[model samples]
Target: MTNLLLALIYLAFISLGLPDSLLGSAWPEIYPGFGVPVSYAGIISMIISLGTITSSLLSDRIISRLGTGKVTAISGLLTALAILGFALAPNFWVLCACAIPYGLGAGSVDVALNNYVALHFKSTHMNWLHCSWGIGATIGPYVMGIALSGGGSWQSGYWYVSCIQLSITAILFLSLPLWRRQEPEDYGANTEESPGSDASSAHPRPLKLSQVVWIKGVKEVMTCFFCYSVMEQTTGVWGGTYLKLFKGMDAAAAAAFAGMLFLGVTLGRAASGFLSIRYSDQQLIRLGMILTAGGVLLLLMPGPAIVTVCGLMTIGLGCSPMYPAMIHATPQIFGREHSRAIIGVQMASFNVGMFVMPPLFGLIAQHLSVGFLPVYLALSLGIFALMQRRLASLYV
Candidate 1:
């Protein structure tokens, strides 16, 4: 039963990832069809991010009321319906309208599942589960590429992916019985605390948003999460466009390279899952950060198309471990009682970056040059590294 539940969780992560990069990958084809500038993709992204932030803010209360099982199942259905709307929408405004429910579904599932896993599973499972997400992320762009190259519309791609999401939602609904038996708080109350960590204050009531933010390192942690989101999403959303605009690649090639980025993430997380058995999460995160910095520098260098692709892969590799590691450590840092609320706030912070930064980058690229994106990503990485280090000090 436990193993089956874990498999379902992995599937949920994959479903979570399927639509994430679809907009970005499809945007190059989509904007032209809509008679909009490429920068218009940012508007859709911002709307989605806003919706995600709102849902994340309400996740704790909603999950408490509905339970994680119902929340995941319903969110999956909502996301599927939203994706279908995206597929069938007649105009850009309809696309924007669809983004609302898409964001809401995504944010709630992400928070609920991450909290559930952190409370129930080992660190390695967190890495592997995210790796499953990476697999879906990787597949999305390739699916887009095939649809576009075959003279099919981006709507076809969205339609196909929406069907997959709907299938997953049905499985999630059927799996609800498993969640009732698998609720981990009853089995692993100790999962939230690290050895030698403070436990006396551990059993406090669930935190309000204000109280979670008032915790010592919550602000800094939020900053770190925000920067990470910016780096990851900027690349996912804009990297292909950047390739086409500057590197003289065609749409298909650019999309393939974008898929490579997520493939790198999938591969990197697979390695990190094994590495977690032997190393601490902090050490793994620091290693990822250093590799990420190196990747950014490679992107900034004057190079061939292959070099830029390699750099994107390196960035994905670097990003692979940090997300899961941070999530896994949340309960340890804030206490299990407070983790769901804290993770909800953390998801909100993540969506804030996702909402705000891509459009800001788009405006700059519109006015300035897409070439500057690497510089922007580098700056985000540097700040994120510093924030992660500072947050680490709180534990030490």
Candidate 2:
């Protein structure tokens, strides 16, 4: 039962990742199809991010009310519907409208699942579950590439992935009993505080948002989340555009290579899972920051096409373990009882970064140069490193 639940969690993570990269991969075609400027992609992203932010703020409350299993199943269904709307939308406004549900669904599942894994599973499972997400992120673009290359509309790609999400939704619906039947021991500890573990009985009262953010080290953690999110989303959303416009790759080839970024993340987290056995989460996060900075430096260099691609891959690899490592530390850094609320706020902070930074960077790229990406990324990584170090100091 434990293994089955873990498998289901892993599948949920994959479903979470599937839509994340789809817009980035398909944006080149999408913007043109809508007759909008490239920078306008940020508007749609912002809308989605806004929805996610709102949902993330409410995650703890919603999960407490509905339980993680129901929230997961329902959010998956909602996201599938939104993506299906994306598939059928005839105009950009409709596409943007669909983003509301897309973002809302994504936020609930992200907070619920991250909190679930952090509580019920080992650090290794958290790392590997995220690796599953990286795999899904990788697959989203490939589907888009195939659709575009085969002369099919980008809608086909959305339709295809939405079907996969719907399938996961069904699995979640069927697995409700598994979530309910698990004992406290089946969770990581004897306390039996899994996200779905009868929250009303266990927690009687959930933490308020104000209370969660007021905890010591919370600000630093949120700051780190913000910076890391900026770095991660900026790279995913803009890497393909950078490759095509500046690096001289064609659209299809650029999208394919952009997929490599998530591939690197997938592989990197797979490796990090083993490393977690020996290294602390803080150590891994700092190491990832170093790799991220180094990768951005490589991107700053004028070199062979392989150098740029390698740099992007390096950035993805660096980003891979950082998020999960930070999240896995939440239960320990705060307390197990506070994990769900803290994780929800952390996710909200993350979406705030995603909401503001990507579009801002797009505007910068629009007015200045796309080449500023590495500089922007490097700066954000450096700040994230500093924030993480500060967070560590609070513990020490």
Clashing pairs in 1: none
Would you list the clashing residue pairs of candidate 2? Answer: none
lDDT digits (tens) for residues 151-190 of candidate 2: 9989999999988989989999999988777533322334
Count clashes in each candidate, considering only residues at least 3 apart in sequence or on different chains. 0, 0
Candidate 1 lDDT trough over 10 residues, lowest sum: 186-195
Q: Among all windows of ten consecutive residues in candidate 2, which has the lowest summed lDDT? A: 191-200
Query: What are the lDDT figures for the candidates, one per model?
Result: 0.84, 0.84
> In model 2, which regions exceed 4 Å deviation?
27-40, 146-152, 183-201, 240-260, 366-371, 394-396
Model 1 ranges off by over 4 Å: 27-39, 143-153, 184-206, 240-259, 303-305, 366-371
